[model samples]
Target: MDFYTVLSRYYDLVFQKNKKALSMIKHLVEIDDHTSLLDLGAGTGEEAIDLAFEGYHVIAADLNED
Candidate 1:
């Protein structure tokens, strides 16, 4: 298995979503009328998933395809 594949298995255990940052983003961006967002280098897609749940259309991109 590749390095990212191994890391992905344990990523969530070691890292959790940053609620403060997500709040900052919500304050900065207008999340209305089906707002769209592109998260480059999005790892594990935790934040993107959160934003999506909040009604924003999020597209997560990452280098590791694990």
Candidate 2:
């Protein structure tokens, strides 16, 4: 199965799935104005977009596909 294709659908699901934990972490990282996130092997960009919406400068990296 093409993992990226499958992952794309569940991308937002992950965030919503872990909403409570993420909210806790966000409170932990309650620091300065400029924050950054690196979504390694970022699949359909859902996580990266979410981080950006939360005021993080996201660096989404992934391998190219056909």
Candidate 3:
């Protein structure tokens, strides 16, 4: 496996969502019918999940496909 593939497995253990960033994004976007966001390099998609939970359309992708 490659470095990112290995890192994907332990990503959640080593990192958690950045609450401040999440808040800032929400504050800036102000979810609406047309509101959408893309989270590139979104390892484990924790941030995307958070935004999605708040009813924002979010697309998350990562280099590591595992």
Candidate 4:
């Protein structure tokens, strides 16, 4: 298996605190339905998923496929 594949299995655990950070960022930024986000180097797509849930169109790009 590749490194990213193994890392993906535990990415959430490693970045559990990122949810709070993302929330803070959301509060600091004003995003509307028309806003589209490009999450470069997105790993495991956690942030992208959260942003999408918040109604923003998110494009998550990463070189690794896990």
Candidate 5:
């Protein structure tokens, strides 16, 4: 398995389940329906997934993108 694969599995340990990570990003990203976002280190896609759900055009990225 690659780094992200392992990283994904342990995501909750690295960042807690109720970690306010989403809140932090939600504040930083000023979103519009047409807005585009690139989420680096989008582990397990938590922030990116939330942003997409909020209707922003989100592109989830990782250093492991090969």
Candidate 6:
């Protein structure tokens, strides 16, 4: 398999629990339906998913397909 394909399978294992940072960011930033977020280096899309759920338009970008 390619490097990203292999890493995708395990990326969540290491970064899933790192979502606490998202909460801090949310508190610091004010986002409404008109606001959009561009998440650079969005690893496994955990934050992107959360932001979408909260109703922000999110663009998740990463070097890896994962």
Q: Which candidate is the best by lDDT?
A: 3
Worst 10 residues of 1 by lDDT: 9-18
1-66 in candidate 5: lDDT tens per residue?
Answer: 877677766675787543486677677878876679887776567767777888779898767643
Q: For residues 5-59, what per-residue lDDT tens digits would candidate 3 score against the true structure?
A: 7777789988888899998998888888998899998988999998999999999
lDDT of 1 at 47: 98
Estimate the TM-score of every prediction.
Answer: 0.84, 0.54, 0.92, 0.71, 0.60, 0.77
Model 1, span 18-54: residue lDDT tens:
8898999899998788689999978899999999988
Q: Pick out the ten consecutive residues of candidate 4 with the lowest summed lDDT.
A: 12-21
Model 2 lDDT per residue over 3-55, tens place: 76666666656645445645775777653567766767665565567667777
* Model 5: lDDT of residue 54: 80
To one decimal, what is the Cα RMSD in angstroms of model 6 from the true structure? Answer: 1.8
Q: Which one is best on TM-score? A: 3
Q: Mind giving the per-residue lDDT tens digits that candidate 6 earns over 1-66? A: 797788888888866745677788688778875788898999988888987887778999998865
Total backbone collisions for each predicted model: 0, 0, 0, 0, 0, 0
- Sorted by TM-score, highest first, which candidate order results? 3, 1, 6, 4, 5, 2
Off by over 4 Å in 3: none
Ranking by lDDT: 3, 1, 6, 4, 5, 2
lDDT of 3: 0.90
lDDT of 6: 0.81
Alpha-carbon shift of residue 40 in model 5 (angstroms):
0.9
TM-score of 4: 0.71
